[model samples]
Target: MNPKATRWAKSVAMVATILAVSSCDVLPRSGPTKREIYAGSVQREGDAFVIAVNDRVTRATAVIPALGFSDSFRNAGAVAADVIRPGDTLSLTIWENVDEGLLASEGVNFTSLDSVQVDGAGFIFVPYAGRIRAAGNSPEAIRRIITEKLQDQTPDPQVEVRREAGDGATVTLIGAIAGTGVYPIERPTLRLSGMLAAAGGVAVAPESAQITVIRGNQRSTIWFQDLFDDPRYDIALRNGDRILIEEDTRSFTVLGATGAQSVIDFESQTLSGIEAIAQAGGLQANAADPTGVFVFRNEAEEVAAQVLGRNDLIGAQRMVYVLDLTQPNGMFMARDFLIRDGDLLYVTEAPFTQWDKTIAALTGSLGSVNALSTLAGQ
Candidate 1:
């Protein structure tokens, strides 16, 4: 080879080396490389703590978002339908066994008392029964008392008491329900689940359905499916309860070498790490580094301490949990691992993927160099 051609060959080799180094930065990759993430996680306190996921890590990080009712919500006893209270209107029918009965007209055998309102003092006035305690008693108890009191006034005075207006026994249902309105707490709709059924169930999917019970100043949210699986969550419905039904707000971000990259909503009550990846279409076959999957999350200090086996971490800690799919127990670990809300699932590109792109860039650069050498007639 000519001396000039040898020089040109050396120049081309140097230019290719430079291009390979610069190509990685300019390449259209999904996210950071495995080495880059490891480099960034070197400082454990200020930066993200890089922890390789295993059985211990999976157990430590398996925290699922809790859905439950507080003590005030569950302990609140239900209102009785039959018990008479203030603002309740009672209807009384008095019957006598004589031709001219007392308190009844000249020849009437029965006299119907309508719109008989119970006063704030829990007493209702009757013609012969006098002011009786109607608030704390049931309809039957009130009827028996009235019959006994009116027995002397008329011969065989048969009395009947019916609750006409029970305005106190009611609950309001709103949001993500087929029927969003106030429903009376009848015999059939006394419990939380029963009242939801009476309101036509939840409008959203069962997995995404969430019910928030606002009783007084205290409020609690629970998952819809928890009623059947966990009986303790289905609390008793009380009067003046405002129930708001809506969808669950839990999601995770999918990025890097996967089939698709986007924010995915949680589809079930609990989501495993592998299940979440599958929902995002799984890892990219040709370019994904199976051993370099990472889950980035902002873990609470308590959980972070448990995960790292150290109690020095404060407040919310940044964490990068690594998963190596090449290992024997990697799949099992991922299956047991749980993905939390706002977590980022990332898979680094294969080592050869960047190399392949670098070679393509170098190959293109060589063509232009060769053409320049030809024009110079070297």
Candidate 2:
């Protein structure tokens, strides 16, 4: 071999060896493994970080309630029962046994009245009936009240009340919908999901969407998937309710030795750690360390304080959670582990993968040097 080629070969091997040695020290090899993190070692202590595998998460969840539908479904039953309110418009028709009646013409027995808007006092002004209370009563109930009041003025008076628009009882469908408009609550059974369908279904897949309900002073949100999976979330919409279908911006990033590295949108408002891994195409089988799957997230202040076993972690941020899929129990735990919005899921490369990559790189460099030496001899 040429002296220069030999020197090149030696230099390439030296560089590869240094790279391999440096790579191993980049991550700790002995202190703890994925199983340890999975088994309750989450905390922020000095320079170390870990997660607890027990009741801590449940407690945190209790403090921070699930967003959207779960919190807002309590009013579904009452909202489903439609009731008239101020700002409602109604059309009244009056009929009398004789041509000479108060509401009907002098020669006519029937009269179709004009539409009237309910006043702020929840009353509608009628010609002879005066101001009739209409709010808080259903259309049928309002009609009965008007008929009873008209009996004195007409001989056997018959009254019909038809609602033109329940101004206060409408749901405005907005954002990421096939159609956006104010949908009147004709019936009490108009549910959250039903309204979505009536508005020409969803413009985007619900899996990656969130449904927000904005009522008078209350606003809540729920994952589209969760809304469909549980019938309880399909709550009835009320008047002046605004339903918004928006794409959930929450995401989790997969890093390190995964089949692919990308930010995955939470198809639903809630996602499990396992599901996140699956979305990332799972860890690279050959390069992954089965015991090093980890999820990083910023926990609530209280939860962070508890996990770190410290009293002063008021606003601590970011902690690591590990899952060891090599064990059967690990798979079960992963399913229970919920991945929050803005989380990071990483699967460390197997320890030897570093050495393999380093060796391959060195071999390529040496091959080029050898080829050059051979060509010089030729």
List the candidates' TM-scores in order.
Answer: 0.85, 0.70
| Clashes (N, CA, C under 3 Å) per candidate | 0, 8
TM-score for predicted model 2 compared with the true structure: 0.70
What C-alpha lDDT do the candidate models reach, one value each? 0.85, 0.72
Off by over 4 Å in 1: 1-22, 43-46, 71-79, 98-119, 125-131, 364-378
How do the residues 1-378 of candidate 1 rate in per-residue lDDT, one tens digit apiece?
Answer: 577776777697667666665667777688899988988884733388899998888888888777799888777676677888776788988889998888778878889999898888889999767889999899999999998998877778888899864666678999999999988777678788889898899999998898899988888988898877887777888778899998988899999999879999999988988898899899888899999999999999999999988877779988999989889988988888899899999999999998887777677767766676666664
Model 1: lDDT to the true structure: 0.85
lDDT tens digits by residue: candidate 2, 81-119: 436778878888888898687867678888887768888
For lDDT, the strongest prediction is 1
lDDT of 1 at 76: 66
Clashing pairs in 1: none
State in Å the error of residue 36, model 1.
0.3
